[model samples]
Target chain A: MNEILTQSVFFGMFLTLACFEIGLWVKKKAKIAIANPLLVAVILIVAVLTLFHIDYENYKKGADYIQYFLTPATVSLAVPLYRQLSYLKKYPLAIIGGIAAGVLTAMGSIFLLSMAFGLNHEQYVTLLPKSITTAIGMGISDKMGGMAAITVIAISVTGITGTILAEAVCKLFGIREPVAKGLAIGTSAHALGTSKAMEIGEVEGAMSSLSIVVAGIMTVMSVPLFATLIQ
Target chain B: MKFLRQIAIIMGISFLAELLEALIPLPIAASMYGLVLMLLGLVTKLIPLEKVEGAADFLIEIMPLLFVPPTVSVIANLEALKSILVPLLVICISTTILIMAVTGRTAQSLMRIGRSGGEKQESRTVDCGKNKMKNKLATGEEEKTDE
Candidate 1:
């Protein structure tokens, strides 16, 4: 029984699911934005792994399967975008412009800020795609010679912060339009932020969902372009 | 059986994207390919929304659950991250607010221009029925205030 529990594949799967369930329960009870399921799951999994002396490589045997699903999960983002197609068509210029501007600001600010702080090249590059989804962010990080691990951390942090503070930021800015609210959350924080967008309104939900894809595509294109131009 | 078929359709799209990723050698991730192809398929009416909606929704719903492992792997490099943790946190929080404000303001201003151009307001109602109802309720309350 103990051996089965330690087996890499089963261990990884069990820990992942168990941690996520616990995280969900905490979120349900706490009803707080900071009770992010992913953060909780990460903390629990890390603690368990450390206690058991299980290295990440061993844990990855089962976890990689979950990671692999990220591809199809990203593909599935199309459904919401499709559901709101007419909305997109009606205001293509505004939607496109807003996302383009958001993507540029996200990338440009990170680049300039990292430079001001004297972060080394790799750190700056790792942060370049931080606002995009992890699936695409990791890919861009790999291509740009950055650390995928760092990008993941940055992406997670950005997502959590965006999810937690989206409402207050919108209110502070007097951003009453649902479309703007959704785009802002999705652009900066990806799907985690979109989840917050859902709580606001359906218009915000749909717009935020659309922004995830648009911002991702724009960031994917722009990051490499900027990398080469700077070099 | 229906759910299985829906899952297959999504996986099939993902497989195709992987194939393209291998062939093209572009910097883009295969998932992006899948996402774009799925969008095109939906746009062209090649795939009905109902056919894949169930699987797609489930996948999105559990999306955070899937990232648990990758996020945990950060443990391996905590030593390296420790020195920069404070800086990273500050940058992330500040930039989130900056991105939110800029994007929201820009989108809102563009929308104002669009509305002023006399784009049919009624057409917007068809896009999201629920939001329209909520907007009516809020405006109704606002009208009472004016009286």
Candidate 2:
């Protein structure tokens, strides 16, 4: 058992899965908003790896093996997407128009704020894709000459920020429209924040989910235009 | 057998989509190019929504797995996190709060519109129809049905 468990690939998967399942249990028992399962597992896995002193490479060997699932999962997201098709079609024009406005406003806001704060060119590039899903954000960062490391950093930071503050921001602005709320966070922070949005209500989750796909499209469309415009 | 074929086709499209921008000599990554092709495919109805729906749903269900590498990296960069933990905490919390506010308010407002606008229209239509039907029905029979 030790032999199998200690193998980096096996250990990482076992640990990741085990921690994830345990996170579910924690969520059940604690009933605390802060005790989100993913956050819990993230903390647990990090602690386990640290405790064993196995170092991350060995741990990653296990994780990377499981990580292959991420791409397929991304592709498979079309399932709920299909389920939501009718809902999407119901107000296609409003959704498309609203999402475009929200995404552009999000980007514009961040860009303006960053510029005011003296963000350099590299940081600007990193911040540009902060609202996208992390994989895409990382991809954009690498392709556009922003540091991959910084992009990931910004993505995670954006996610956690979105998670904690989505409602506060909405209320502060009196933006009680579900579409607006969902679009705002999903546009600016992507999946991590979207997960938090799910907790507030089903409509928000659906809207935020919609935001993810639309915002991905918006970001992808805008980057090239920005590249040309900047050059 | 049918589902398997569907999965394969979807994956194939996804793969094709991934590699589409290789022809471009632009500074952007090929995958980014692929996304464009995918969008075009989607827009053009070349790849129907159902074709990718199964796969896309599967991807989101297991979304956390995708973050494994970075999570491991977190372990690797334990020292760095310790250094920036405060900022990280602040950022995550602030953003989350903001998002929650926006989403909740939007849902409430939409719910209001749906409730108010839809209720009045439905009531007007249904009430008028119901009154007409009631007027045609015998009063005794209507009272019995109501009871």
Candidate 3:
């Protein structure tokens, strides 16, 4: 048993996912907050690694196998997109147009402010794509010569911040409708924030989910343009 | 039928983007380039947003899972991140607040564009869609009064 726990890649993934399933059960019984099982798993794994004095590469020997699912899972996002076809077609211009303005303002403001505030080139580059999903943000950072590690940290913090305060900002600015609230959360913060927004209502969750893809595409389109603008 | 076609187009575009990424040696990762390429195809009507929304939504739904690999990578590269910890922290907080405030306000202003436009009455409805209108217009506004 000890050897199984110690050396088996399957054991590691099973243990992690078992914890995740337990998290699902926990959420069913109680109010699930930022202290989610997956998030806790992150903390737990980190702690276990430190306690055992195990190198991350050693853990990856197990964890990397699970990582293979990321791509197919990502490709799966298309399901919801199909369901919301009527609304998507109805507001084609409005949705895309709104996201365009949102993405440009997001990238442009962060870039200019970071540059003006005395950040070095690398920091400026790292900060450029913070609003984007972490995978893409890290990719942009690498391409533009920013630190990928810093970009990941920045992306996580951004999602966390958005999770914590988006509602406050929504209310502060008077975005009270479910769709608006959802869209704002989804567009600005991506998936993690959408989970929180789902707590608000179904409409918010639906709209928020829709916003993630629109915002993602919009952000991607703007990357090259923004990268050149900053340079 | 329509839904399936859109899914096909999006996946097709994604594959093409992936292929292109391999052909081009950009500093960006090929997956990201695939993403960018996919987005261009969608927005330009080359792929059509309607066609890809299904697959895109499914992918986005599972986004939290996507972070798992990276979070692991985070642990793997924990030592590397430590060297640049302070600046990374600064970038995260400041960038979050700044993006939230600026985008929120900009979106707010765009929502407010009805005051002088010919349809000011409809503009508020557009700005913060009445509950019924919201259901009708998926892109409509919210109660900005929540501010």
Position B48, candidate 1: lDDT: 92
What's the CA error at residue B35 for candidate 3, in Å?
8.0
lDDT of 2 by residue, B13-78 (tens): 557645653554443433333334544566577877776655555555556445645645765655
TM-score of each: 0.88, 0.69, 0.70
Candidate 1 clash pair list = none
Please provide, for model 1 over B1-147, each residue's C-alpha lDDT reduced to its tens digit, 9 standing for 90 to 100. Answer: 999999999999999999998898766778878988999999898989989999998888788888777778788789868866776887788898899888887776676567656553543323233334433332221221121
Worst 10 residues of 1 chain A by lDDT: A1-10
Q: Can you give the lDDT of residue A150 in candidate 2?
A: 56
Candidate lDDT (C-alpha), each: 0.80, 0.57, 0.59
In model 1, where do residues sit more than 4 Å from their true spots?
A1-6, A228-231, B120-147
lDDT at residue B135 of model 3 (Cα atoms): 34
Write down the C-alpha DockQ for each prediction: 0.43, 0.16, 0.26
DockQ-based CAPRI category assigned to the predicted complex of candidate 1: acceptable
Candidate 2 local lDDT, A142-202, one digit each (tens): 7776666655666776675566556657656555455456666666567766666566755
